[model samples]
Target chain A: MRFQKLKRFSCFVFYSIFKTKMVKKLASKNNKIELGLLENSSFKALLNSKYQFSKKIVIVDENTQELCWPFLLTTFEELKEAEVIVLPTGEENKVMEVCFQVWGAFTNYQVQRNDLIINLGGGVVTDMGGFIASVFKRGVDFINIPTTLLAMVDASVGGKTGINLDVHKNQLGVFSNPELTICDASFLATLPEKEMISGKAEIIKHALINSRSFFDELTQYLEGVPNDEILAKAIQIKADIVDQDFREQGERKKLNFGHTIGHSIEGLLLHNKIEVTHGECVAWGMLVEAYISHEVATLPKNELQEIEQLIRGQYETLAINDTIFDSLIQLMKHDKKNNSDKINFTLLQKIGLAKINYQLEEDVILRALNHVFGQ
Target chain B: MRFQKLKRFSCFVFYSIFKTKMVKKLASKNNKIELGLLENSSFKALLNSKYQFSKKIVIVDENTQELCWPFLLTTFEELKEAEVIVLPTGEENKVMEVCFQVWGAFTNYQVQRNDLIINLGGGVVTDMGGFIASVFKRGVDFINIPTTLLAMVDASVGGKTGINLDVHKNQLGVFSNPELTICDASFLATLPEKEMISGKAEIIKHALINSRSFFDELTQYLEGVPNDEILAKAIQIKADIVDQDFREQGERKKLNFGHTIGHSIEGLLLHNKIEVTHGECVAWGMLVEAYISHEVATLPKNELQEIEQLIRGQYETLAINDTIFDSLIQLMKHDKKNNSDKINFTLLQKIGLAKINYQLEEDVILRALNHVFGQ
Candidate 1:
């Protein structure tokens, strides 16, 4: 027992030293870069030390404000005095009108440049709130306390914040990073099962591109893991990718795995006011697009089958006619991709490997759609 | 005649060498950190160079969309294909609804990440348009083509963009600078005289704080030089100050000059839906606040007279009552300068100097109000 205790103590010390060196290296790499993600097994200490904000932080949504404040009140202890802005919830509220309300709150609260805004909801809250702070007084610091799984894995990490313009999604925005993100998975417990599934899609994308082992681990543990562990690992996957590509200048585009078609589908569904979660539509999108990759780009039939099988296993497949598929393709063309006119896809060469310019043929997309809808 | 030519050549050569050295030194200083300013300059060049975007850009406003689009089309030489997203004029249209419409145009036109949003109109268009760009797909670059005097002087510079909430001014926002701000004084020729007064107020504020010579020059030339050179210099004053404190950390607060009460009064006037322009209300706010500064801080009687004489000489002053004054003071407390309970003022020590922590007793404010009211 004495020998074991001594060995554990030495291991702990060594681990601490290793972590310090790693964090210092990371800090150096991301100097003057606000939008950054930190990933590691034991990053709790480093996170706690880094985010030292004063008392005037504002939480920008009603549901998230209620759910997140008490814990943040305890964690940042100093943040107990922070004002809660609490605008209405959902994508409908992610409008320029809501941004006005947020700006008013900062003025009403006399938010200073050094002050912080804590965005404590899903993508809408994180994106809009971060955008508000970014332009509020030029730009004030903000932290993302993301609740939903999608935000934890995708929205919260990147510095993409903005409201929708016209019928488009994220048609207006700047790439501005928050000062820190305190993502405690406890927030995920309050999320709906559908939301969890939506988040898992992004996690699955990450695993496919970066770690086959992680994919296996996810497949194994996804059945019935504790919420805390699931959330932690999911966030860890996103953080790892973000750390590698702080901006979407390179590998970060891979993280948009399902998003290309996902966003187009989202815009279409939103315009129609159809009842569909962002993730659900994106899941279907990934499945169909993956089929496109298989048929057009000559991706191995085995890889294509696996992709379809996994997506079908995870989500409820939706049937679409040619009209819908054509409209979807048109939407993709309108995407930030197709600079002049070339359909770009961030596709997997194999599990754990991805490339951005792997163009798929039009016939392949049609075939994939047929496969998905049983035409 | 020969001597004159020789002298001119020598002067030109000396100026060229000096200009080279100055550019090198300025480049070095600005290389570390600095600011850029321009008057009615072509943003097309800067934004195109920065992001390698297409030269064809579109400017949008209800009125200008009709008037300016022709010129923009001719300039970019893409009238055949360039897309324009026009929205209604006025502060009411500066909402999320309009932002959506703008993004819709962007998506429909297949606008890329490197695409530009040229804000054409007053502060409303610049603020909302910039806010839209700041948040779209994370963010896209933007340029301010301020068609109103108010936008050219204050709104276009300092990278401040936001939309207003109900009964609040600039409630939602992010502080993101445009790649270039094209502030053409020729645009001012189209502006109503009321808007010109607003621009003059900001120029006066700039002169009051930093440059006595510029202040003197403006006092002499306020009604004379409504041209590019003066407009460029006014923009330069703001740009230089913003470069010193882009985030409004310390010295930048002095730029508030009269904006503390000025903004509140503007909000009040806007709430009441009065005919007063923004600058007119700020002029009154400055008068009241200056009187308060004189009474409380012993702001040298002669200098106080000069302030009163300067504003009174240039602009019309309304007979504000005690009740109105009392309410205005209450609004001032809600200003960002107030820390919890204490109201802070960026009071003028003399014509060219500002002191931020000029705490005044309540009774003194009352006395100043009475003096301004001519009670």
Candidate 2:
């Protein structure tokens, strides 16, 4: 009887492995957009067969150059002729001056429209590189090889590309899609614990907006990199939303659930010269917005408590003073997502459902903030 | 019998006037892109009926603000709340700095995505304004109310919006269409003789590229502004070509017959601080490219001579020395149209036939330049 139980366990493990391989293969082949797992042999084959660029330029941030580019160079022989353009690391570098420098590099190289720009870094590299390619000689084709988990699940999947204007986040940009996106989970292994926590916020966001089961699964794996199945599910959720609304005209706004307040916080911190990861701000934002959701969006009190508990357990709670509250509200007023001076938000109706364009009163917003700060 | 003859003549004149008005009305109503004559009631109706903006902003250059804005304000009551954004007059200001300033103005004004941007000047205003609106907050709706004949027939018609990178013309840009374009012939009355000649070159180009009969008709009306019928026909011809190939990937390239060499010359002259109008460089380009066509693409010798005579009669032939020749050739090499470092020329097979992506040898190009210079 013990031998039979051991055999059943072995079979289950074999089936799981086979299923993952099949899913990866299918992802590289069929999707609304061409999303490929880079480690998949089929993705490598597609790159070798389809793309015959005259020149290939790989744009990498300092961190990515040290951590990601060596693996990329060794895996793809086509990149032997690829020129490496190293940009400085951090969100601070995601500005117009950096774009100007990158554009100048493209001009110097005489990069043609048919040439390939491989954006190999986190969100900053992908966003900036995508914008540069979209404007250079009207438009050029580019591929996103996102090395960070935040990029793989969030930035690289969405066609949105931009750079900050002074202190404003994503103040200047265009809607331009990359030719292909390769999201390899192996890069997550080398990520620092802080970076991992930052990436986890987006994964948690995907779950909170789409599926309760996915949320439970993700929270269980919060201590380390979630398995390929969980990552793919998170990515697919984002891709489905982005595919429905590339311009964020309607359904796409739901993806900005935590982002409204998150961007304000992120922008404020950046402007104040306080270093903070996007995910950390977003994690805090989700917590605050969840409270707002409970009041205005029919989000249940129990679910809100669970969300707050999960987020608070993972991330350090922000110290929100009256001064910071005033500034945050002021920043929210200037958000690009808001129309006609009315602050619009995407709030969770429940654990798995989100409602967009919710206009909340100032008092309610303040009340929500007070609740978040335990005032 | 004499009374009857006079009655018939009056009837014929009345019918012609009615038909022109009817055509103008139809153009504003039913077209792939709305092409409206600015003074017509239909254009005013469109502004009143379709576009309801909370705020209206007019973008004009120093020259246009002085000459055009007052007339626009007086004509349309909808523009009572309109703010004027005056840029410096000249192609020199069509750079990133100007774009930055325009973006800053839009941000300061808190320009919403639905707000109207009226580009009320020449190609420079339309190009820069369109690009700024397109990139600002992903995109905002804008209208082109072209004051110059050059802008009406060419720049404002196509969705190609861009600004120059230093001396290079249209080095950075995006493909974005304006919501509406209003072309008023009355503005031509106030245009300087030099500016009028500049606008005439694009009209001449349309005739040369598409219709021999139109070419003959345009040459007859060379001294001043052509009748509304002739202007509309020129505008229609360009609109048809642009609609056929919006991206310039294939058939649309034929429209760039003179622009390849024209841009090189324009860029070189601009770099050297020689103030040459775009039309003047294009006029010279049509001459040299026509010679190249005769040698390479079997363009009839008689047709080439006719082109040369018409252009030469209208404008002074550019004196191309060996010094300028080298620079022009160097500029041509760096043209965005070229592939694999080969200089591509769009050569005319005949007066009404243009072939694109025709690779030319260096010696052939040199010979063509020498022939133009009468070396």
Candidate 3:
């Protein structure tokens, strides 16, 4: 494993010097994916396997124009030719309109049916690019080169790709798996601090649901420390769950611990231009939902308190007003996990275990939320 | 099946005495799709068993406000509690933008993650609505109520739902199968002539590829035939193939016999705002590609001539100029089926069997184009 890290470290240095953002993200992010150094070697072998490497590798992104194109050209030099499509970046740009742009690129570039599309960027780039690859001619192959940590631990794995329709986030998408992904921790150094924290939400969720030791490690390094080791641990935790339940039908649902209310808060905050980070909002969601879990859903109170304390330690807590509460509830109803009027939350049954759809009453939820808001 | 059609007929009353374009086409056109009888009953049953249904049914569409809403309310009174979402209609509206509209509706209406979304429209509505349902929260459930022949015979079964991104059609989408699909032929009586013809092309393709007897039956009443038995036969053929190869890895690609070139033509026509139907373009593609197959790939000359004759009888032959040819080729490059510069054509190795990527050179394809254009 240590030798594997050394090899990846060398690969990272080689990938970084001349590779543009697109290829850099691909080589960098993928290199950093903490799915155990040994596991990553297996994934690398899979990429080289006859089944996977039969198609041309095409990296799709706009910002990484200079970055990805030249790098892919050199990397897959023996594969006849490779393609790099540039799409406009940003969430607002992540729509079918962008998909059309990508399709045009596909057509213009002559992307084949079996060719793999390597999406290189943050979530927006990967989401829309993956989407374009997914449906272009009824889906071609795709890989994710998620540049941000949020993407590394979250978007990079799940294979959920989509662009927004109207103001709602990820409103139009698909749940398709990728052929390969390369998440390099080195790319995290390039991201804005806020985006780093945004990625932390998913990391926190992973720690909260599966591994108490991981949680302890994460808490100690909440601000900053030992990026490589922590990243590897986080990646291992997520990969294990994903491997167990790919479709998120059971154990995978537990990954949504903070996401139920977190998504609603993020939706509201994004809609209001409230400038709150995704990780921060999810932290708050974990706090409140954990409290609810303790009271009505059999989650341990100590764990709930610890979760809240940890969240408070990392993020500035916000007050949830009546209007916000109403909207949050309204948004929660749209969550794909809800059954009828019952808004389902993934609760911690213990510090290192989770359960889904812990249906607490509206009043009980409000009380738990109030406690978190310090109201 | 006959009894099923009879039972559905009682409830299939055309909503408006004033026939819209869609209704008029359904009443007049000879698109043989078995609307009332569900063939993939087992698939639906399997899905239902997997998830506990709070809402037994869902109706998703744009024109539902005018057509399906009143009809469903009166007919399936048992579904009075069933939720209905009215989306914006049309190809332009089949986008991530509309998906957001759906998510907003789901949110506003308190649609849960576990609830089902029943798509009730043509290709645009089914594709977009299905895409929304597939990604709502993470994924919920979806059903298809294809009103147009294009959707009923093809889009309804394939689990290929997506919206246009820019010039690319169905570029942003997913391949999540619906729990159920209700392809009521009664909905066709309300479709317009143009829309009916658009769907007819696919019906013709199915007949050409799978069942010659069905083809013989179709030619007898191409212009005007409202017989439910014949329509059901056509739909059954599609359902049979769909059931055999749901993921489109093998036998399902046969369905794209004309689509490689056909889709490029549609993209070019749609982009240039040319007056060409999707089916019509595919019909032309079938003719040209068949010629290429005969000349380059050693197909029986008689089969080639039969294809040409069948297409010529239905469509007013159109000539392709150098510019159009180049543009079409350009679009074909991005057909999501290419490998390198080689364009893949799903051509008939025989009348009943189609081969994919039978690498036809540019000159050979052009010569075939000349034959179709009589150049």
Candidate 4:
């Protein structure tokens, strides 16, 4: 954990001395992610200096255009001419058809390889925008300005850019990095309470699988918004894992501790037109998986109790129907991580450690689901 | 250029020594193209060995399914269980809608990370299939079995995988290489005379941009299909240039000599419901670009004259309306290569030499368009 902070700090010093824009930044391994506070990151310095983009595009949803775009446009004078493409808000709109429309708009604008795309929304905007830019004439570099807490910590880490296909989560995507990511906590002021809770779920999951010290510190923020230090620490824990395995061939799966069930549940809810935030699904998923981990893997009973108490206090329990357990199993089988008919999972060996490639049987998964839902 | 063949030869030896099967393979630099005669390749050897794919998928178009699939099926017993997905024929079908359908099929088939996709068709199949596999669940490794000469030389050279967007040619795409690319000349037996001429256009462009000696050798195959040696040489020239610069920041643009105008003309025609082969467009485009090279670049007058005569002798001249010259110019403005208002071009300095980054104006492009169309 110290080494992770040390690496990010070294990257900050390197960007400061060379670029002349002093921001708390980290080079997320090979992704070349230059992330910092938006106020500190000088867009004017970047645009006016040696970097000359032919066109600048800001991809925002209806929400971000209204809530965040004005602040961004007035703060950076160089971005006044940047074209704005307002996407329809929410996870349902994150699809290839939407990407196709944005690409059509790009064609209408004659967006070239020299242009830059600034994604100014939550995870959907960043993910869909990243995919659009990555596949447009091979690729065009982009800057991600995540307006949500989930995006700042989660999107800032793995460098995974994607859009969903039907009932499958992130079924179509590529491993592409943004040229830079600007994360200013000021935007979190506009985020809903549920979103804030949704985001904190990830931070809790990060601590559970990465560091005991991180989990211990998170107790104070049980009902409060985390400060900049806590946010940076959560990002670093994920970055440290992703830095080793960008392709998710091995150690990277450790970061998928809760995401295996989270994605399946999230996708099932999304397809059914149910209004469930991704973080809410992930939170419930972690609780269910934590139970399985204690029973199957070597996660201690007392450690599991601590996790259960923390999650129960912060999140509402999901009232999943017993009939839907089979559907959940079906979605898990279709998860992108699985290479065969069996479901693949990453469960806690203990707090601060996770084990990958756990091909848990159907009955075990069903029993775990029942235990969590009290069905 | 000689080092390229030597490098490929060494790679062939490497594959031969390591594996039981011996194919006349040429490793197209980092693309790992295992190109050779179809009969010589052993799918069974590779399948049963260290490689363990969970599923096998073969993507073919209507044309390849009828004329080529039987040959492939009878030869490789290992592919018996492999599911076949047939796509609609032609450049018009090469769109995101078709890809969406194929992805839906992939979902139904439970295509996973360890699955293998064998693209067994012409340029449309290879290109679109490559794109589909590249984006599905982030990416899945694929093998390319090119059934057309255009794909054998061009697609095998540069690792670009793409699909057309609306009337725009290859507007949505990515640069990704297959795990293996097998180019069998036997597929050419089913190819139409028009298609053969189209393939020759690229081979001619390769020589014009790379080697005078290669150009001299090509004059012998004026009215005939190029031998394996000629195909290998054309692939080598492009591969040699691409090995130097894969991203097309510099030298790789030389390959776009014919493509700049070729794409514009191809797109314009396709939009107007006119059918024109990709190679026919390229051949006509080379004549116009050669005209530009003579006027703007320091290309020898004799070299331009030779190119004109050879092009006139092979390709049926296109009757582009005088009014369409403005339309062609408009389409050229939207070309992905252009970074500014001025159109970017790669013109010949001489036979076997190309100069990149020539920002040609609209008026100059119109003049060349008129000259080539005889308006």
Candidate 5:
């Protein structure tokens, strides 16, 4: 037993180091969607050297238009001529209706295929802008300048661009990479504490799925906010996984460790017209899913307790009763990740190890939810 | 001068033969999207060997549901258990509302990612179905069983899938290819003569852009209907162009020879509630664009006359007055093909030799329109 434990520990260490090295290598080589530290000179150089857009359009929400747009315009002088298109703030506006209005705006402005659209906001702006650019005249080139921490580390790093359909998150979308993703951490300075915590949920997810050391490092920032280095590392981890599987055909699905249940809870809340940040729901989801991982995938008890405690301490546990469990399960079955009637999940085998395409029985799921709710 | 003419003739012969050989080689090697005859044995064999769909859904219009779906069911035993989704026939129904309904149907049927959606109708069905499949759960594999000549020769062969936005035709769409496109000339038996003529416009455009000999062959079918061989060759011509430039960056713009003015006229008619076929507009477009080719690109007057005469002989000329010209030019300026303010055109330097991204003066275009109108 001692030898077996030692062998497992060695394997984990080797795998973690190898993964970190691989991610660093990929981050250096990745030119398809460059995730760069937002600097005026670099941004100007990128636009002049790479893109030859006839016209530039900036898409932002009301919040970003007020908070981030001024700073962005000042930082990038090339954007002075760019037309500003403002959308309403929040996830509720991330729908087909908003896309229709945005498409109409493009038509009104006569946005050509060669012109560039700069998405300057959080997940909603980037996701909707990417979708708009992708479908407009079959496609147009666009760059994402994520102003929110959640978007910078997770949403904007991945090429998965989409808008919500009805209540389902990212139900209507395309796998289209941006020309560039400028991750300016300075934008996070003005973000609310809730928003910071929301972003941290994804960062925590990245660490739990890929690196135990990273998770330990993240725990240090649990009482505070993460620095630029930590944020860049999380982004690099996601970029590496995406590089391996852009379409989520294999290893990329590990990113969805918390998203499946998280999305369900988010969708249910959205459908009910309840206001909740994406990260809080994901925090709740990780707690419950971690429990399932412990029971089904043999996740170590100590690690499970640690994960549960960390997530629960950050976010309030949602009251998942029998009725809510039934609805949540129904939402899970409707997930795009599922095959036929089976609900596939990305479960944790242990900290820093993820098992993708894991299927569990309905009773087990219900029991997990019951445990999460302290039933 | 005589020696120069002889040399030109030799070059034409050599180029024509080489192009044909190249196209044939490409056709044989293209495994991503197979183009085959829709015989019972071949269709049955294709389904069995190539795809392993759990559930099959047949997307058809009311017109094709009656005319073609029964024939399709008899041809493939695998489609015996397929669900029928009947959409309303016509270009008017190609919108987001219909797509919303179709997506709802997919959800209701629990259509999985691995399941198949066989588009078994004309351009509207194939185009709309392809769009639906591409967007549903990011994408689902689909096959095109084009029931109309327009669809078989043009729409089904290319990966361009779209639905119209309000009055703008194909305003919202994606460049997503189908798994296979089965072109059964047998479906042409039930097609009306007008629809056959409409399909011939694209074939004529294909010939004008690629081969003079093919144009000569097409003229023979102007007085009468074409056979399966002629239809297959037209499809092959389009397929070759699409294979080279799937995104319309360079060589593929040649395919839009008559479409600039053609789409404008079609859009205007649709907007004004004046019903006109896509082929008739394209036929008129060919006459005007051919005139432009003669004036700007130094196309031989004799060759230009030949094109105008042949097209005018088959389709009746639509009366274009000064009032319509303004709207037509305005629409042309808004074309997705245009870069900035310039109205870009694909003019012909000579027959079987298309010059893409050619710009013509406004007066020249107006003169060409006047000439076509016999003003």
Candidate 6:
């Protein structure tokens, strides 16, 4: 009892020091991205005030339930009455059956449209949880507290929520925005080193697509997780693109520069039960696409080599080459961006600019895979 | 070969008589409602013209697949090559499992984002198919060809697309508008007499909430399905309310006058495997709510008696008793329109006006149910 009281007292002290007076908020047309200390958030005022929310349902994975939930629960008085829905960790659990179960639980809890759902976990938790909240009673208001680096810089910004259908990634989804997203750096302490590195791949992709300076900065900070500045820049790049094209009908395709190949490779490996982070697959996917860009698109050979070396030095490449190419191409053809029989690619024109709607041939893609994987 | 050619020639002659020059198009900000003859609509110029659609995917139920799909397939050259996804008839199959199977079919068929989905059946087909299209690839363009009178008047207009979660009606869904809603009165010939009467409940609700003249007109024509004028007026009432509040944050609750009590009774009866159409339950639900409105919300006793007489004359009340009131109230509390433990109801102030956000006590609701069902 003494120890518990001490912890609560310390939390109150910490909260008072880092109060919301010095808050950092990024605005997109769809939602607000609150990036700073959790104590210095607008959440405290919103949750503890004259809010009309009937209930608080917090969705967390096994990891976040243990590592992150306590900090917020201790800080906010309103959360004392919150019901927690803990999800199983990892991408493998991101499927429709899991979503259905969570939805059934929501019904059991009598979750209403006026209730606030707080997604307090990594990518799978946020993505699948967001999907669950969005579909339940035709979407309730949700606050995403992204716990992992990958979710903070990438998944946190876009209003994309989905769960995989079989081997296909994000086969079923809806574009539903959350009410607010809070990216607290304190949660990074709970993430594994591998998970942190895995998230950095999206940061690299953001820099590759939009800013040469951000790419240069990413090269210097290779040893550890990205800081607040890096997370903000990466998130801003995504938010800017999404705001301009919320539906991905036009300019937003630029953000999918590495994702087309990344999803195919990731889907293939995950289906076969081979362990690989999404960031690792994306790092390699970028290398393969860079090679293709140099050969076909206007990307210079030296720049392609620079990208290949950067990714090769950072991420350990996957095994198997010639045999996987056919299946890989088949998976790529199933990509959501495609409108025809041909695979749609977003390739780099240069270091900081991307070209969308590139319908490259199968043989060309295979040759690039051979060059990247066969190495 | 001669018969086939003769049928094609007849189809062309029929289409020519009701050409595109005289299209009856009602415009909403979200979607266009193409009323009257389908041949007089813009679908021809869109499909046969310089449109970029790679494929056409038509979603139909068993009933419409046999009766309606052939009509469209023969009329439009584009639909000749269109693929069909046939669902089973009735509300029992409106679940996640069906959506999952349909999504897998979509994957196998390589249905892309730019591809068009044509929903060609009654409420089940349009509601479930719209959801399938909306979620797959984060929404694809779909056209709703509402076959049954219920779907043409109610489901086709509001941009509400969803499937039932267990016995609960439309528990999982999104608010996604269709590209076009083609309401061809010709398909009414395929509907059973029971189904036509089932759809009249909504038209009656529309009249009660909006106009007295329309209600009087409805009283005179109590024989078969509603004509085009009634269809247009019923659709317009729903469309106008939806346009003002698409997300149902405010004024749109007026449309939910009968739904609160209706869904509860429908859910209870459906779960128990008692045969009932949605329209029948809704008719009785209106009677119960009208009784409650008269008791507490300034609705005239004469108006309540009139509504009771009209509904009692039309729909045979379900076998619900006082014992069922507790469970029915439980279901009403689970309604999506509700924000708290109190049941949310839209009560009638007069014959042509509704008051929304009436969170009434359980005793009042029980009294109303006792009055309606005890007789």
Clashing pairs in 4: none
DockQ of 6: 0.83
State model 3's lDDT: 0.66
Ordered list by lDDT, greatest first: 6, 4, 5, 2, 3, 1
Q: Per-candidate TM vs. native?
A: 0.78, 0.92, 0.79, 0.93, 0.91, 0.95
Give me the candidate number with maximum DockQ: 6
Clashing residue pairs for model 5 = none
Model 6 clash pairs? none
Candidate ordering by DockQ (highest first) = 6, 4, 5, 2, 3, 1
Q: Which stretches in model 2 have alpha-carbon errors above 4 Å?
A: A1-50, B1-53
Residue-pair clashes per candidate, as listed? 28, 0, 37, 0, 0, 0
Clashing pairs in 2: none
Best by TM-score: 6
Report candidate 4's fraction of native contacts.
Answer: 0.82
Which of candidates 1 and 6 is the stronger one according to lDDT? 6
**Model 3: residue A16 alpha-carbon error in angstroms:** 17
Cα lDDT of candidate 1 equals: 0.65
| lDDT for each residue of candidate 1 in B1-375, tens digit (9 for 90 to 100) | 343334334533543432321211112211121122221233444544664545234557776765455555555443346566677877666666666666666666666766666677788888888887776666666777777777777787887787765545665567777766665443444456767887788878877777767767877777832444456567677777778876666777787767766776677666666656677766766776777667665567887787788788877765356667666676766555554445566777767777666665567666766777655
* Candidate 3 residue lDDT tens string, B1-375: 343344345434542222321321122111222245333223244334654455644545546556555555555444567667666665556666666655766766666556667677887777887777776755777777787778877787666767776556676566777766666666666567877777877888888778778777887878843355555566677767766776667777778788877887778777776666777888888888788778776669987887778788877654456557877776776655556676767777767666665766677777776777654
Per-residue lDDT tens digits for candidate 1, residues A311-345, read: 88888865456668788777777676545565678
Q: How large a fraction of the reference contact set does each model reproduce? A: 0.57, 0.51, 0.67, 0.82, 0.63, 0.79
- Please say which candidate is ahead in TM-score: 2 or 6: 6
Docking category of candidate 1: acceptable
Separate DockQ for every predicted complex? 0.36, 0.53, 0.42, 0.71, 0.55, 0.83
Query: Per-residue lDDT for A166-245 in model 4, tens only?
Result: 88888999998887777766667667899899998889889989888889999876675566678778887887888899
Which residue window of length 10 is worst by lDDT in model 3 chain A? A23-32
lDDT at B103 for candidate 3? Answer: 70
Off by over 4 Å in 6: A1-21, A49-52, B1-22, B49-52
